[model samples]
Structure formats: structure tokens, C-alpha cells
Target: MNAKDPITVLPTDTAVSQRAARELLSSIEQAQRSFGVASVVLTGGTIGIQVLRDVRAFVENGFTEADFSKVEFWFGDERFVARASDERNEKQAREALLDHVGVPEDRIHAMGAAGEFETVEEAAEAYARELTAHAAADSTLPRFDVLLLGMGPDGHIASLFPGTGLIDAQGLTTAVRDSPKPPPERVSLTRSTISSAREVWLVVTGEGKADPVAAAFAGEPADVVPAGAVAGVESTRWFLDEAAHSKAAERGA
Candidate 1:
């Protein structure tokens, strides 16, 4: 209820990243135990990438039970850039965690690279087909065990920026030809697909994100702060640091 009711506010960005590491491992284990396979939808951003590094640190620091080889890694959104480009979320995530964890190439379902497809629409359609291919019997989309999303200062999640028609985009994935941020072309999972996860966690930090975080917690409409429209089938978690939670704390959220 109320999208997890009260959000989890950590003390710092490091603290938020550390908690994300723990949450991901715990959720992965749970999912693996129940479904025999675990899936994670990753995001891109400062804190998002840090979360992966933190997870790697956990494994390096004697978390013997940490096994990601079987986990399916998916991207909530990806820059339709060259596969080797640093702008691509897949490349960043692989360098940060997947490479270190030995998740293998097949388990890493990255969206189309820039030159692989003729257009962003083709890339998005390809990603949608991939998801459908991995779906449960009679299901149109795969079961995403843990979906991590990063919210922008403007409260945008994935490629669904505020005031864009993509906010209400249907189906599994959508192609963005024009993004407010740089690298205009991108492929992103729709809000419908994001909400399909068993656990959807919003990992956000910094003072610049304070206003929109507060607005989302205040139940603002999706058109205003898209984060408000996000949740999961089992749980919707809000992870924030002190600076990002400042305004929400002021409002008694």
C-alpha cells in the first residue's frame, strides 16, 4: 500500500549502494529458490552502477553463496549506441559486475547495439521479442525477479521522462527517438513491463533529486513524476540517501 508506505532512507550514497547490494543478493536467492532461475532488470546512472560494484565487493569479500552465473541480467533501458561504447548501460553493467561475476554472455540479454539495427524502433522490437521468448508458458513477458530503476532529478525512470508520451507507452518495450538527455536514441522497457517485476526498487540519491523524490512520495501523478506510477507485483522499494530524502523528510514522509 502507498507504494511501500514509508520509503527507506539511507544516510549516504554509499549507504544506499551498500543496501542495494544486500537487497539484490537476498532477492536473487529468494527468486532462485522459488523459480529455479532469477532475473534482474538493471538501470544505469551513478548510484545504479555503484550498486553493482558494491555487489561485486560483497562477493570478493567472502560472500561464498554469491552465485550469479545462472541469473538473467536484463536492462530496463539502454542507450542505442555501439556495444563497446561507455554510454550503453549493458557495457557499464558488464564492466561493473557481470564480468566479475561470470554471469556469461547468454544470460546477459542486452538490447541491440547502435549498428546492429537500422533504427531505434527495430531495436526496441528486438528486445520485446527476446523478452517474449523468455516468457513463462502462455505469458507474453518474462518474470523479472528483481527490477532496479534509477530516477532522475526530474523523477524520470528508465527512458520514460516526464511530459513524454512514452510515460504511457504500452507493451513491453518502446523506442525513444528524442530524449531530453543526451544520446537521443534509446530502447526502454515500458512501465507495464517494469511493474511486472516481483520486486521493483528505485535506487536514487543526491540533493538534486530531492524535489522529485518528495513529489513522488507525495502521490504526484505520473505525468508529473513518473516514479509515482511504478511499483511491483510483490513489493515496491524506495532507496534514497539523506540528501535525496531531505524534502520528503521535511514533509514528514
Candidate 2:
């Protein structure tokens, strides 16, 4: 779907998380049925973590684990901190789902953490190499079946904040420095790389995100709202809570 025409799926704050969990499982099942394996890119944030937890609950409630083993997980961005740091997205995901899901260790690809690389730039380069090695023959990115993302109140997606040069970054991954958010350093997939996915879901919640959500759907410039810059090859979905869609509702979107 186009940036101005994302498929908006609005459910209540509590319901959205449950729905996202179910959809994620269904998507993985569908991808594995069509291909031998399924690849997914995960995001990190309040609602993002909730979705992971919900997925774990769904599994604990007698959902089959076989399909989950065929899935590969990746992060959209990561804090350039110690691997075990709470700031690390991968660490949060592991505590929420990966550790409980039984996904293969080799298939869980995380960005380089502090102490593993000399600098954020080095970490970014290493991640780019890893992605390149796994990319399809004719593409520079993996054929990701589903890519999940969360938008910050200021319109940042992953680690690409508005007005930053990284918003227009052109590689598989880029090092982020002086980030407006804490830790100030991160590694993220570029817009080009994220756009290569088959499906992208912007899972947003809370009233703070209402304005940016509307702006993105209205086609605001990427420099003003980085979330407006990315879309999936086959589909772009905006999974939101009612509070998050308030502005969009006002604009009749």
C-alpha cells in the first residue's frame, strides 16, 4: 500500500495487542506454507513489547509451536549498548518471546552490541554484511515476510528521527549517533532496506502518536515525519488504537 493509503486497522488499546498477536502468528503460518521458512523483522517499544508478550500467551494457550520453529526473527533497530542491557531491543524481545518460543538460535539475527564492535559505525557495517549475506540473489535485503515498526511521538521510526540525515539513509543499515532518545547511539535498517519487505506494519498506540499518525497518512514530507517515508512492497498497514487514530479521524482519513 502507498504511504497515503495504508490499510488502517483500528482496535482498542487492549484489543489491538491481542489482534496483532494473532495476525503475526497467522502471517508466519502463511509464509511458511508458501515458502520453506518465514522471516520477520521485529520492532521495540511499549506496544511492540506488549504484542510480543501477547504472542507468548497465545502460544502458551495451546497454539502449535512447530510453525514458530520455522520462523526467523530480526530487529528493525537496536541500542548500541551491552547485549544484556535493558535498553537493547533484542534483550527485551528475548525476555518476552524468543526465549519462550523455541526459535532456532542461528535464525535469530541481532545487531552488534557494545563490546562486540569498536564503534557504532563498525557495528552498522557488520550488520550490513550479515544482511547482505542473507539477501536474495537479486536483492540487497532478505525477503522479509513481515516487518513490524513503531512510531515515536516525534515521528521517528526505528532509530531514524525526523530531520536527521539518516532519514534518507541508503544502505542495508546505518549507525545512528546523538539520537534524541537516550543512549544517543543506535543501529537501524535504512528506509530503502525496510521498504523491501513484503508487508510492513506500523503498530502504534496512545494519544501522543495521533498527530504524527495523521500527518503520515496525509503524505507529510519525510523530513517532517520520517514515518511517511517507508512503505512495504506489497502492503503497508497501520495497526492503531483509538487514541492513536484520533487525529486521523478528525481529518476524515
Candidate 3:
């Protein structure tokens, strides 16, 4: 989808909550059939956690052999210092979804959060190298079937916050030295990298985020907002609950 298209707003969080799971599984199934493998890049936050939980529930309920064995997993961005085992996104995904799901261990490719390197820049380069290794020999970009993302009140996605230098980063990943958010250090995919995905699905919620959501979706000269730039190579969609969409409707109306 084009970055200028109108945003789709749902009636309630519960509605999106119920539909997102089926949609995610459906998308993965379709992608895997179309391609030999389906690679997914995950985002971190409340909506991220919700999506993970929903996917896990779907697997536990039924469809045991859902063909996720061919699905490869990766993270869009991650904190540099925090342990991957910490109660953050990676750990949360593990506890809520990945660990419970039947995805093969080799298929899951996450960031190195153990602080193996002394600096975030080194870690970012390492992740870029890792992505290069995983990509097809002819293409440096992995044709990610799905990139699950979340939006911050300030219109940040992954670790690319507003007014941050990382917004202009060119490679697949960049280390954030002083994030606007907590835990100052992080590694995030640049806009260039995120745009390589075949599809990007942003799951956002809460009334506090409504205003920024509206700005990111309806504002002109969208370049100022990082979230406004997350257009996938082929398709992109914003899935939002009612509370998170109040300002968007008002702006569009």
C-alpha cells in the first residue's frame, strides 16, 4: 500500500484483538505457500505483546501442523544492553509466543542482546552482517513476508524516534546510542531496511496514541514523522483499535 493511503480504523480493541490473530496466521500461511519460506520481523511494545499472545493462542487451540517450520523469525530492533532473556520484547515474545509455538529453533533469528560487543555501533554492524548472511545470494535484502510493528505516541517505530539521527540511517540496522526512550542504547532497522519488506502490519492501540496516529496518517510533509515512512516494498497496513483512532477520524472528516 502507498504511504499516502487512508488509514483503516477499527471499532474496538477487542475487534482488532480477535481479527489480528487470524489475519497474521492467514498472512503467514499465504506467504509460505507463495514462497519457499516466510520470514517475519517483529516489533516491540504492548501491541506487539498482544499479537504474540494471540498467535500463541491460535496454535494452542488447533492447527498444530500450520507449516511454521518454514517460517523464519527476526527482530526489527532491540535494546543493546538488556539481556534477550529480560522481560522486554524478545523475552516477552519467547514467553508468550515463540517458546510455546512449535517454530523450530534454527528458524528464530533474534538480535544479540547480551552485550557481547562493547559498543552499539559494533552490534549494529554485526546485525547487518547477519542479515546479509541470511539473504539470498543475489539479493542483500530478505523478502520479509511480514513485519509486525507498533507505533509510539511520538510516532516512533522500532527504535526510530522523532528527531533522532537514526531516522536517516541507511543500512539494515543502526545502533541507537541515546534513545529518547528508556534504556538509552538500542539497535534499530533504518527506514531503508524496513521498506524492503514485502508487507508491514502496524498494530497500534490506546487513546493516548490517537493524536500522533492522526498526525502520522493525515499530516502533510510526512517526512517529519518516522512512522509515516514505514512503507513496505509491496504492502503496508495500519491496524488500530477505536481508542487509538479518534483523532484520525476527526482529521479525515
lDDT of each: 0.90, 0.88, 0.79
* TM-scores for all predictions: 0.97, 0.96, 0.92
1-253: candidate 2 lDDT, tens digit per residue: 2545555556677788888888888898889889979999999998999999999998989774437788888889999999889989999999999989788899999999999998999999999998988887798778899999999999999999988878898778999989999989999999998888998898888999999988988888987898878988888888888899999889877
Q: Give all candidate RMSDs, comma-separated.
A: 1.2, 1.4, 2.0
lDDT of 3 at 145: 84
The whole-model C-alpha lDDT of candidate 1 against the native structure comes to 0.90
Question: C-alpha displacement of 103 in model 1, angstroms?
Answer: 0.7
> In model 1, which residue pairs have backbone atoms overlapping below 3 Å?
none
**Top lDDT prediction, candidate number:** 1
- Off-target runs (Cα >4 Å) in candidate 2 are 1-6, 9-11, 64-66
Q: What does the lDDT come to for candidate 2?
A: 0.88
Better of 1 and 3 by lDDT: 1
Give the Å error, residue 101, model 2: 1.2
